[model samples]
Target: MSAPTLYELDPADSGIYRAQMVTLTDKNPYAASVYVYDEDEYRTMRLLVTDDGKAGVALKGDEIVSVFAHKDCAHPKSVQSMLSQATALGGRRLDCFDTVLPDLYADAGFVPVARLRWNDDYAPDGWDYETFRTYNGGRPDVVFMAYDPDRVGGDYTPGVGEYVEDYDDGIARAQRYRPS
Candidate 1:
């Protein structure tokens, strides 16, 4: 099958917006409508494929597919193609929260940097802090992983321990700086 064509959905495109809303809702009920709405506001990108005789979103590329599949699909050539397309028109970085994609991104020459922690003030009511910590304490949810376009063809060696050590150093530094 031909790969689904990618398109940047305009925020004003109600049909695409609604389709994405429906897709997000069906796939992830826990996600708030505001999440989709906000994503539309900022990064309006989607991959469309015909499913059940209707246009629907699919994994943008094999990397995303492998992420969903929870396995490694290291297609270096495919990664290069997607990276080229993404960066051709001035792309920043590919942002994804799925754990599986981090390794693939690393293999594709993207460096896995420190994960982001959402402050407590930003969390919604009824959000499970303990559960969240248990599930993602060591491995944070929002990780900034990216490949340098200049060195796309080279192998990437990820510093897995760096994230942990950095977190510890940050905590120690903050404690030391705190007023006693």
Candidate 2:
């Protein structure tokens, strides 16, 4: 097969991406949110999109290598593409949270960061853990790999807040991940 092409999606493309996210969530119930941001916002925040068009938030600081991609696009190339973009943008640390895509991220250089488990405490009302655990029995683990923007080697760093915003407690709880 030919190599898949990567494109930076426009905001107007949210409908298609959101639909894909829904499909992913159906397959992995622990997924509570799948967000996509416009290029302007993405750039301002140092985020990136993968070849399959999954959005990622870029985390910079303490070596500058962290990204959060939506839990779809279980392809290694997609993670690599995001890493490439992050590197091009001068980032050094890369992170993603898709257990299905860990191998891909690993091959590209990300190591397992932490295993994430969710319950009703992290979900909204009407959400069901039994259903979620059934859907994603293994649950998803956070994976991270370090990249050096100044050099040509990949390193690993732990404990950096890549996806934390001071939203309401409920909102914060919903978006919480290992702060590294």
Best by TM-score: 1
For model 1, what is the alpha-carbon lDDT of residue 20? 48
Task: Give each model's clash number.
Answer: 1, 7
TM-score of each: 0.45, 0.40
* lDDT of each residue in 49-96, candidate 2, tens digit only: 455555443533322322344544445435466555555655544444
lDDT of each: 0.38, 0.42
Instruction: Give candidate 2's TM-score.
Output: 0.40
Q: Cα lDDT of model 2 overall? A: 0.42
Candidate 2 regions exceeding 4 Å error are: 1-43, 46-79, 94-98, 114-119, 124-180
Candidate No. with top lDDT: 2
What is the per-residue lDDT of model 1 for residues 1-180, given as tens digits with 9 covering 90 to 100?
Answer: 123234444446535545545454453423321133344432344433222213323233222221111012223124434444454543434434433455656554555444445445545444444544543552334444444555454443433422323334433332232111
> What is the lDDT, from 0 to 100, of the residue 103 in candidate 1?
60
